[model samples]
Target: MNVPTVPMLFVEIEGVLRKTPDDLGRPWKGPFDIEVFPDAVERLRLWKGAGGRAIGFSQQGGVALGETDEQTAVRTLWTVRERVANLLDHVVHCPHHPEAAMPDHARCWCRLPKPGMLIAAQHEVSLRQQERYPLWMALLVARSPEALQAASDLGLDHLHGDAWRRDGGQ
Candidate 1:
């Protein structure tokens, strides 16, 4: 009998960071924040050994309420890296403000709800291994329902609302 190996799970940050209040809403406190639950780390180790890869991640809110776009981007990336360093094969950051007053051309492609980062990661992985899974799933753990839907529209198999409390079951 051939036992089907479980597919690797791609987790997102932001909503998986901590249970904090923000523009969207409150997320469950992730295991990384408290250090009490080893679930996050354990999951990472499993994924790394099994050749799993996280697709993309973005800040929960568009920076703080009044913080500059640059500040928010920097802080968000730093936080994300620190939190998911164990499981993440690669990370991407979107420096543009979703509500910025700039022209559309000025925006970058790393933003959530967009598949640029995921696409890039998938390409990189494929180049390295030359193996393509039947289903290429990209999980987005943001608070914006709109953003989730956008990602879904972009052909991602999974779009998670929040990663903190999410259980990507086998």
Candidate 2:
């Protein structure tokens, strides 16, 4: 058996690259206002400058709950992607939730901790680049135990987001 050696970085968006709306007092809205952490961006800048690729793995469940919609969710992601140049190569967001108000947004295998998002991204990368999985690192926020568990389930190497940043994202 052979393993794929594409060396892609699978990263968590909220709480990792960008500071999320944990203190917003409401579900986040579209046209995302949060700034990507400076050090995080610096790390990614260096990472990409060295010819590495990164993909943001996120779940925009606000669409499911009626706080936002799918288009807005997608736009927000692309908006962020435009902000940071040459860091993230792609973005994958899941708008599903088991308790979604909209029927279509409810229940999916793509939410974090489920591996759907990662698997889909895997296929996407392999298809587009003709190369595949490497030892992906799920750079997760320290507060998210669920993401850590999900990374383990996906059989990828993992690291704490803050620590990774502090370590200069090596």
Candidate 3:
């Protein structure tokens, strides 16, 4: 039997890419100084070299906490995109949290442990590529339990730990 394949990958940002912000709300001031974890760049390269498509997913509730606004968050992500242009195909961010200081920002979808972002990305990717793959067939590379749980809920393949390095020293 012949089987079709989709070379897509979903990766988490916060802990996997950079150190989890000391305070998600006030991680940094002035600009987003993303300190990428060791082997993060390399991992993306290997995955791309193997012909895997990569999409970035991050749960950032900083904006809702009144630390920043949507515009700032987008700008930060834009900077990240510029740096990882060759590796990432696209990025999806969640700026909502249940405990948001801003009432308007509270209680919304797109948070991890919830499949909103993944489902949205899947739909967007399917539309853009003009092809659909079962959610379980997609691969998730990350080190966040929330992202991993979200992957599990969606039945996607998930990998986590030490920037995906063999040694747990990331």
Question: How much lDDT does each candidate structure score?
Answer: 0.49, 0.71, 0.72
Which of candidates 2 and 3 is the stronger one according to TM-score? 2
Residue-wise lDDT of candidate 2 within 1-170, one digit each (tens)? 45445466777777777667773555555575756677778777876676566788778887889877888888877777776664777788998887876666897888878888877876786777666555543333333676778878767778788777677546
lDDT, candidate 2, at 9: 72
Return the number of clashes found in candidate 2: 0
Candidate 2 lDDT trough over 10 residues, lowest sum: 134-143
Using TM-score as the measure, the top candidate is 2
1-170 per-residue lDDT for model 1 (tens digits): 44333243444554443334462364434323322124555555655676555544554334332344555455555555565554555555555556655545236565556666556665675556555533443344445564566557765555353443445333
Report the C-alpha lDDT of model 3 over 52-72, residue by residue, as the tens digit: 667788777988888778888
Which residue pairs clash within candidate 2? none
Instruction: Report, for all candidates in order, the number of backbone clashes.
Output: 0, 0, 0
Quantify how close model 1 is to the true structure by its C-alpha RMSD in Å.
6.4
